[model samples]
Target: MIVSRTALLETLSAVQDTVSQLIGDLNESEIKDIEDYLGRICRHLRCSRNALVSINKLPSEILGYIFQFIHADFASPSRSWIEVSYVCRHWRRVALSMPSLWSVVDLRQKGFDVHKLEAFVQRSKAAPLTVFYQNPPSDHLVLRALQDVVARNMYRVRHMHVKADVCPPFSDVILSEPAPSLCSLSLWHKGPAFPLLHANSARALFDGRAPLLRKMTISACALWYVYRITSLTHLALYNSEAHWFGDSFVDMLDGCQQLEMLFIVSPHLRLATEVEQQHSNRIVTLPRLHLFYIVRVVCKCYPLPWLRHLLAHLEIPEYCDFRVEFWMTDREVVPEGSILSIFPPPAQFHPLEQVATVKLLTTSTSKSCIAVHSKTLFIVAHGDAFPLGLPNDFLCPIARIVIVNNTETTSFLLWRTLLSTTTHLKTLDVFEKYLDTVEFIQLLCPDLGAEGVSPVRCPGLQTVNWACLSYPDVDLLFGLMAMANDRAHCGSPMRAISIWPSVNGEDKRTVEFDSLGAPMGYFTRESTDEDCPCLHVVEGLIAAATPKRPDEDGW
Candidate 1:
């Protein structure tokens, strides 16, 4: 039974009168006893009233554990976890007492709340802090507040992310004292509103080398500023301006010897710089580098030699996965052949005994993406103004190619050029719009019309998996049959063909054909493995036939 309001008020009034009567006569020990009794009575009353609620009975430790699940990324800040404190006095105490919940302070909001910021910092006490602050494009009080807080808590910060329109001259606040606890730092600068500030120099983030620093992201800042921090293991740089000189970029790569992954998306390098010219001919080797990704946008003034010089000089390990994607709107389009040369031949540097898999994905009329995977190399590229067709001689001994065509605007001539290069192609997986094209049919059977004029493409072609929307024509069916028959006569037969047909309107149908197309299974909305299990069985057969490649052969 719940206590009535009148009873609760009377009980409080009586306790207050008793306390008032003893105030003058009671000694320190008597006063302490009364305070302890009141605390116990309040807790007991609260528990008894909430006894039937399951969550209310949870221990403080359990409540703290539940609060740990709430986390927010710095890009977007949400403090919904604070709602837990408003539920009841017990919850409020528990929420405020948990330091982990207040360890991450985000000050990216337009309106700075000093009370909230101070509360989080105070509750965190000695716990390590992860701070995220973004300075608005214009002047704001939040920027000053953030600067003060960061300066004061430099010793406590473990991870810091700052994005601002103008660079802050705060090397003293960050690097005056050694940051033993700081491990990760990300700083991004939006271009200054005043052009004069654009020429402002960037000071080194840390006065001395950050011994424990392992990861960093610097954007729109001087590229060479971070060369002093040699302990970095993961580094990402994004500068849309002409901030990178070839020498500075090379020096940075050489300096960060511990880096395992490096990502760079920037404007064209300043190749004409005297410093860059001095080191343009020198080669730099990275023994431990594993993954490198570069995306660049170029105009007529910035030629391919800058990128070519860098690629030609660097000596990476066989295990490194290197990828470069570029967009060029200049009238003088760099030949696809030159871009292909950026990636070395696997056979020379990192040879694989087993055949590799290459994927071609053309998403639009002007943009395309491709990925080449081998035992040692995994290269991928994407660009709006790059070549739409895959380079045939870029990588060797490809066993499989998967083409994903998303747009109907893809050129048939481009598809033909791409297919003509796969000499050892074994399995072809074509999706959607390209399945019913005459170009695809001709690729399979080069001897269809004129018997001896042209040789058949993909001589080692074993299987074809085509996902179709419209019904395949009789001509396409006959062309495939002829190719299979010709290969069989030559003592090498095409193994199988699998077709995935989508249901259109009320036309629910199953196809049954003879030696030409009958054996190929049809997949529908309700088809199970029992109905179309040949694809899996054939894949297993292929895998079983292929042997494991040796390490030394992985090029």
Candidate 2:
């Protein structure tokens, strides 16, 4: 039945009286137990009634905030705030008139009606819009509905996300008119070829001035069409061969003075042909560029000398590489110095100490060891490049280390060194084959009189995420937890230790965890998934083991 606010409040008052009368006959302890149970019901009813009444009397601005909160929280398209509009006449008008609530339209559900989508767009009024299209490849109706919305209020769209197997063809109807309000555009095509759009059309779309176009991402496109995008602050081009047209790509960046973050993935970095190299003396300069990432490209050498030249002009502090092409030229190799020379000196314009995270994917041979520092380092080693002696100053300010290798000996050596040094290390994540050795467990908790170092040295370590896929040992697992408990009283308290049986899968069985005190929690084959349960155990153990003051006690 459709109930008014007055009627709902009257019903809640009656329910409250009944609960009070029932508790009147109970003793002190019984009444105290029932207090929590009855209080929840009263609070729920009161909130619902208050929301209904406030929908009629609250200021329009205040009502708009509540509606926006509800819209953002209800991400599912099937579960909308329209139910509030159905509550009563006044609520229906308030909800329908609040254009902000309808600004974000998510059309991800399968078999979503195009007409309903059109209705939603209309209800959004003239407010800036965000549209997410996540439908199947064959769902042409969804595309048609999106086209309809764009055609009507293309100027009002501020952000757009399209996730489909194949992007709908970009025609004059979709691109001829400029979307002046469009600031961010993310298009994901999970299919093979790029969407059908003329090169001229693509160029025209970006050639126009978009002062607020700060971020853009385009993945897996066919042709190389780069335009002058003047206002772009961040740009990402993935799985596209734009490097063949390097001149146009450089021209695009030359236009954007405020560009900061740039990512180019698996790009076909075409070298300058003999004719172009001889004729062109133009040097492209990106003065404002800071963070640049290059990944999985097939170029034999660093393709963009322009990028290196630009970095020489700026003050960058962090750098990363994934399958980058490092040229082995005679002049590039340093004789007796160190592998650290491979990295460019911190901007002479700025101080080297400002540098923070330096990550690389390389073989851990004696040569690569020179790059290791006391700062934050994330290394993914490959092949026989394991078990090398690391520097004593290794992990000086290192906070996190993730080692992904299959060598047991190398893993043991690295783990021992980390347990011995790295005084400030907070998280140690060891993956796959590294945890298979039986001796590593002994190293975790050395004998009292043994000359070897013990886990007690890593007093500041709070979390350990160890995944041992093969040869899982229950005894060694408990022993490690016992060691953590013994040392928790000293240093920063050890809150959680998560042990994953293997990298391929998790053991979720109900394992006994009573042996380890305050800071320890265990989960086996029956408990939960690997990473999630480990995170939960960490939080729970930290809360349980942390010391509290008298005034910090709960009510």
Candidate 3:
């Protein structure tokens, strides 16, 4: 007879109560027998409950596909696929039966479990593997065990990334057999700058063959071996040596005509000889190239000829986006009257000639950053080295729109130098937080008075939008009214002017119009609802909520 669920629970509870009373009266041996019998009953009940769950009815193939999304790696062994298998016997069977679910083995992680690695290889069957090895301990027995397992499956290995402070013994030795399935490889050496394997040894390291190799990333030492692989479509060279460029570099570029993306970073340079000059003079066109990026991390010294030489040689399509960036640190402050070096003349560099819009931004960190439109040329500089004056005549026709955000008085003064450079500037948007209101008004709309000598800096500027910190005082309000009156007399009235003051709370806007019924924008004040009765503490709260960086301002 089939029993109801409630009756089953009632009977089980009665049996449990009786067992509990008998356990107290029984001898140790008799209690052990009862415990074993009870264990079997609980296990059977759990299994029966699991069978009733709807998910247990899924086909093995569907269950296996779902298990692939479990995201297991050696980094966090507790969260690996082994955890999923522990839920039920049927789930464990399904997970174990799927080979693709155990393909990527990241052995670089701490807590190296040889059993799990062995299990992965066993369950993977014959699928190709993607492996990452970095910072593994030097346990000889453990290393030997891992090597043996990899040796048995080396032929099926495909994508591998090896980053280690010190080279592991098996790194080169594992490639003794040709990996027919291998396609992508990235090797990073974070240790001292020592020569990687010799050119011949390096070529032989990969058995002088990887017919299907399409992408490779190598640093200083092994770059000479790039020519051995002509089938490459994407290449990245990090921390490249001086000797790698000119002929060898260009030859590598020539060989990889199929390359679509190229990235070079933090490359040191040496003065180019006449032979290198001849190689650079020869134009190398990459028809398939779409994106090229070169970045130098910190610039203590100006102008790297090799980079200039590399840019001069490549003839990429107009549709392609080419970008170059040089970072200037606080340690390298610009010498007096030499700030123009930061903004090099367009003719000097072929890429900067096409810049359309320029943004000069000052952050609370006492640093400034410039971003130029051409889909390229982003300069990040720390400390105060403003790009002032017209660096060259090339920028004269290019820069039409300018935006400046200055948070300190020092940066505000530095920005005036940049404004003087662009003669044809149409729109100027200024955001300043630390400047005197009367002085700011005098600079924008100078009080000609009886002298009538100085003129507005940007004569072509038709529209102006300015924002600054505001108080309850009338100084800024009277200063803006005087500014509007001056602009009307000059016959080039501002198309629109918006003065925004960052007060304590929500924004309140009040607009006005001129005698001719022309609409003039208004200043924004903090909402009255946020008015704190405790006036003494308002400053502290405002300071606490203010962001200290440009990015922290949320755009």
Candidate 4:
């Protein structure tokens, strides 16, 4: 007989009361049996209730797909999207049936479980794998076992990344097999500068069979030989012995004609270990090569031809976005020559020559690095060593410069040097927190030149926008008025002057002409304590609610 839900519950309640009355009279074993029976009933009741829930009615395929979205290799063992499986048996069954959800096995953690790895492999079935391995199990036997598993599943492995501090024993042995399905690979060795492999036959990587490999990275490691992979498009080498490889490196480039982006970054040079070997003068022309980036290269002794010699071998496309990061090799002496060495040869187009705009934002780090790119150049430096006179002739194309959120004075020479080089600069915007607007005005409007032949600084400048820590006091206003009049007299008349957010009017209030009426725009920003009595109180409450970085002002 079909019973109503309420009637069924009433019947169950009566049975529970009858069982309670018998519990006191029953023996210990009998009571245990009754408890087990009640537990089973409770499990059935939970399943019944869950069946009535709306979401549980979703098809198993949809539920499994949703599980895949939530599943991630965040941590191991417990914190998995698979946790949803524990909520119900149906979910567990559905999750087990979906193979792709368990494909990526993160064997990077120190506390990784081999049993869990085995389970994932079994559950993944025939799905393509993207294995991430770093700082894996230290035991030699365990490493071999893990390597065995990877080798067994090599046919389906699509991507693999392995980074180990002390080069693992299986690092090279695992690459001996033909990776038919491999598409991308990254191998990083953080150990001492030792040879990456030991082989008598000089076998190349992947047995020269990674047909589908499109991207590869070799950091602080070396291969026996440069194998030709026609499909490689992106290649990045960090701290590798590319200079020592010499002709072999060029041969590798020649093999991959379809290569597009190449990155050679942060090579800590070691001359004692390597011998100077002469390379062929033949320049390899990469027809499809577009972006070539070299970053953070240092040679304590300037005029090292190692890098320049290497670059001379490659003829990249003229319009390619080539970028180089140059660090000051010798701080005591002026590094003009050292800096010049890193810049693209005077024969070719300097990347910085075409930049129309430049932006400088102060960082929290003391150490500085300079990045010169095709469309823009980012020179991150300390206030003192900030590359003054950097915007020389090559930066003449810059029409606008924006300096924002400076916590300290960058350099006096920086302002003067910029003014002298900016031949076509029309817009200058400075959002500063360290210097007063009056100070900026003084720095900007310097003497005309020797014998007054040269024009005023920024001869073609027309518009100026400035924001500072302190509000526009009377002195700042007077300084601006004087600056405007001086520029007008010098034939570089001001077009428009703008000041945004006096203090903090984040929401753009009415932007219009100021009282003086010489403006493209002006906006009344916020005022601190003076403007609002509860401002400090509200700020304190907000500050107390969240975490702050060490470099923050309040922190």
lDDT on C-alpha atoms for all candidate structures: 0.60, 0.54, 0.57, 0.63
**TM-score computed on alpha carbons, candidate 1:** 0.61
**Cα RMSD to the true fold for all candidates:** 11.9, 21.3, 11.6, 12.8
If scored against the real structure, what TM-score would every candidate get? 0.61, 0.48, 0.63, 0.65
Candidate 2 lDDT score at position 540 = 40
Task: Count steric clashes of candidate 2.
Answer: 13
Which candidate number has the best TM-score? 4
lDDT of 2: 0.54
Q: Estimate the overall C-alpha local distance difference test score of candidate 3.
A: 0.57
Best lDDT among the predictions, by candidate number: 4
Cα distance off (Å), candidate 3, residue 401: 3.8
What is the lDDT for 471 in model 3? 42
3 or 4, greater by TM-score: 4
Model 4 per-residue lDDT tens digits across residues 1-555: 899989989988998899878866889998889789989989998998888888789999788878877766333454566567678888788878988778887776555567877887999999988787776345555566578877798888888887765354476566777888988888787676544545433565678778898998878865524344456899988787545446666777877788999888787675523536654777777878888887776654434355656566777665676655556555554444333344435334334456677666554454455444555555554443445444222443778877664655544445555556667888888777664424445665544222433334677777778765544443344455456657667666776655544446341212122223233322122423344443332233233323346775544
Q: Give the alpha carbon lDDT tens digit for every residue of 1-555 in model 1.
A: 899989999999998998888878999998899889989988888778876588878999998888777645344556667678887877889989988777888876645477768888899888888988776565456666666777777777889887775444443355445566889988776763221232223544454545778898877765353435577889887763443435656666776778888777764354335224434555567777787777664433323455545565566665676665555555236435434544434443343333376666655432222222234223222222344344344556778767656555533545555567777788887766544344556667745534443644577777887766754554455466567667766656676765554423232222222343233333222322445454443333233333345653322
> For candidate 3, lDDT tens digit of each residue in 1-555?
999989999998998898887766889998888789889988999999999999998888888878877755324444566678778999988877777767877776566577867877888888778777665455555556666765777678877776654234665555455666778877677665544453344454356566667888876544454334566788887886644566556766776778888887776555435224444456677878887766663444434445556656666654466655555555346533333343435554345666555555554453333334353334333324543444444464433443444444344344445555666665665555554523334456454211453534565555555555654234344444455556566654544444455533234222333543233322233322355332322333233323346554521
Ranking by lDDT: 4, 1, 3, 2
Instruction: Please say which candidate is ahead in lDDT: 1 or 4.
Output: 4
